[model samples]
Target: MSGSRGIVGEKWSQKILWICAIGSAISLYLVGVERQTQNRFQKMADDLDDIDYSEKSGGDGT
Candidate 1:
C-alpha cells in the first residue's frame, strides 16, 4: 500500500510540473507578443507625431 502511495505521489508531482512548465511557456509567449504589439504601436504613434498635420489639413494653426 505504501509503495502504491509513493507511485501516486510521484505521478501527481510530474503532472503538476508539466502543467507549470506549459503555463510558463504560454505566459512567456504572450509577454513577447504583447511587447511586440506595444513596440509597433509606439512606432506608429511616433510617426504620427512627426507628421505635419496642419500642412496636410491646410490649416494655419487655427
Candidate 2:
C-alpha cells in the first residue's frame, strides 16, 4: 500500500515487471516460427487436453 492511487511496492514492482517480461518472451517464442523445439501444447489448438497421452497411460499399449 504505497499510495492510494495504487502504486505497488518497489520489490513487488520489479517482480511483476520480470514476470511480465518472461511471459512476453515465452509468448513470442511459441509463435516465433523457428520451430526447433515445437510447443506440444499449441499443437492441439482444438482440444485443451492431448488425447494421445491419455490413451498411452490409461489405455493398453496396442
Worst 10 residues of 2 by lDDT: 41-50
lDDT tens digits, residues 1-62, model 1?
Answer: 99999999999999999999999999999999999999999999876765668668876644
lDDT of 2 by residue, 1-62 (tens): 44743545666888999999999999898777656435544666434354666576795434
TM-score per candidate, chains pooled? 0.82, 0.40
Error of 1 at 30 (Å): 0.3
Best by lDDT: 1
lDDT of each: 0.90, 0.67
Q: List the residue pairs that clash in candidate 2.
A: none
